[model samples]
Target: MFALNRKNSTFNFKKADFPKLYDLLSKVDWSEMTNVKEVNAACDFFYNTLECIFEACVPKTSISKISRRSYPVWFDSTIINCLKHKARVLKKFRMYQCQRHLDEFKKLRSQAKFLIAKGYSEYVKSMEDTISHDPRKFWTFIQTKRGKSRIPGTIFVNGEAISDPCIIVNNFADYFKSVYTVSLDNNYSANMTTNNNILLPKISEDDILRQLREL
Candidate 1:
């Protein structure tokens, strides 16, 4: 879990703070700290008190889950604002069916739809162009959109709930191994030989080698 403690972790200083800081420092009795026979205790108290004062002045901080892909590249703030205005207009129109309000809402709704479609088309075009120049980025964008947001806490294998990480990995390994493992005595290699009786033309190995060299 991510934690943010604004009071202690951050100092949002403003011009107004200079006066407050000065006053705070002035109110502290430096002589009393000096009178403490032990140097470490006096230093600790002085610094701790100063820290507390600073924390008292700063604004409270708020923390939330880190947003993943909060907004797509083609999202237009102008269009969003227009939509919001249209929603308000719609509510007013519904309350009192004035032709002016109804017409305005209809026009705004059509405009929003058109702009949204245009944005989507442009976004797709940009992605296609990016795929040609940088395939890694194109795939990354797709993965971020399609990727699972949460990992399964437990996996069910053979009608049993399995939660151990190592067990889960081993189960997948065993499954894939069984699926791909070839039979040693299947005579699969014999089928790869070319049949001379076939009517189709067969290019010689030398011809293929010569073509590769030409490239």
Candidate 2:
């Protein structure tokens, strides 16, 4: 929390100010801080919130399918909708993006061992930390196909889109395996249109850009 201010060859308050600074500022009108802090807080929440969500919503067996297909749709849709109001605030604060803080949220997933849980806490924590620190080779959200039991998907650098027809069938085919030979497209199309603005069919536009940058 300390950084040199080149302008004055001195310390800057943003980093230098800590406990006392926060206490003093506590008296000021921080009504806007709620809106302001959420700028990147949404992204941070996405990283952390989704961990528990995946564990609870997705079974261990089906996670892989969800990760490869349905997850992108669910994750993006969940995040975008959950943070719709925050996105607006972020837009307003474009001039003052706290890249450092925003960047920190980007690492929350890697720290999932402590933040999240599984049967194996230690090993998963180590792996999660490593992955969270690096996005190019790590993806925060992941899942397997939906099923009775399973942790289907593990986060990775990349995977199949949630809406892919191939993914749909591979994951959910069993449910319809006996019903019909209908294409997974029917499901994909229906889900996509239904979730539109509320939930995305894939990862965020920003993550795509970051991935592109790495390439």
Candidate 3:
């Protein structure tokens, strides 16, 4: 029911079908990720099958150090790249930082109050008020000026610039019969696999698994 991936759906690879594509990926034997892989495989299949699905390729979390180092080439590549340049409807990307950044983010809020009021400003905000006064002290090794690749400069949310960028995505795909949700709100809202339904997309849990089984 949640229409999140509906544009830029096709791929130009030799084997574009998800089932076939997954078979090729199975050769890699990625360790201890059977369950995760199953999900990814099913999702891949859904993307391939859904001719109307629109999705974007984005950078994986920096936490996945091995994958980042190993597959530098695959960073921005997706199962389906939008060669057609379809209009992408993305919920503005966000990042949730440590508590130390809250005051700074608040300062930024004051600084950006006028801009924050605008729809086009895309202001970043902190998730909490409780943290150490020294924002940089919170992040031990990752420093603002130590030449980190991803984070270019400090952008205050509330008043602090979070150490990293994370985001929430919504798109519609046609072949997906059931719904799965991704949250675009408070970082501390709840664990991703929560018991409640409202924060997530509308879909029966059984239907969700059934769609997975399809892959």
Candidate 4:
């Protein structure tokens, strides 16, 4: 079960009174910060004043912990609309208890199921078709479904499990150094000096603009 669990604090910036906020900010004596010699104290005073003004002008809302199931990449807006319509139909059937509403609800329910299955099938087919050429897309989709970071919580070295982040990092550095370290023979050093003496062509502004346009 892949789920996301977190809480966030947000403010409705769209609903804020910009005029009042601007007026309050303009009224603040910013010159007072200049009198403070320490840069940290000046920054603290500025931040506190802005925070107070923001709190007075805008309301803060806290989002409760959200535990949501991960949806597939194939779940598009069409499927969303179908599900919403199905829900509305079900609500109508329950409220009216009419035969017509019940029939409509059943029809929509079947349609929604069919659409979902078809979407998944198409998604799988596309992945299979492109796996040979673009395997990254397939792996990226798998990672999305996993809904967790790729970083591991523990690393093992020489059959001993190490969980300390600093030790794990040092182990990685040592392993990489062992793998990449190269012996500097006299010939290799001479070849490197020769390569360093070779100058490459300079790139112009037009070349950069052309590259940006292609991107």
- Which structure is stronger by TM-score: 2 or 3? 2
TM-score of 1: 0.46
Steric overlap count per candidate: 0, 31, 18, 0
lDDT of 2 by residue, 1-215 (tens): 22222332432233443554445445544354456456676554444443333333333321122232232322334343334434444554565677754544444433432333332354334545556356432343222223322323432225744554456556666556767765678878788778765454778867966664554
Root-mean-square deviation of every model: 11.1, 27.0, 28.0, 13.7
Residue 118 lDDT (model 4): 97
Better of 1 and 4 by lDDT: 4
Clashes of 3: 18
Model 3, C-alpha of 149: deviation from truth (Å)? 44
lDDT of 2 at 98: 73
- lDDT per residue for candidate 1 within 1-215, as digits (tens), equals 22234534345555236667778877877787877889888977777777766766554334454545355556688767777789899999999999999999999999988988898788767776665456676666666666642344578997999988778888888989989967664444454454434355889977765664453
lDDT (Cα, 0-100) at 192 in candidate 1: 43
Q: Model 4, residue 117: displacement in angstroms?
A: 2.3
TM-scores of the candidates are 0.46, 0.14, 0.13, 0.40
Q: What are the Cα lDDT values of the candidates?
A: 0.70, 0.44, 0.37, 0.79
Sort the candidates on TM-score, descending order.
1, 4, 2, 3
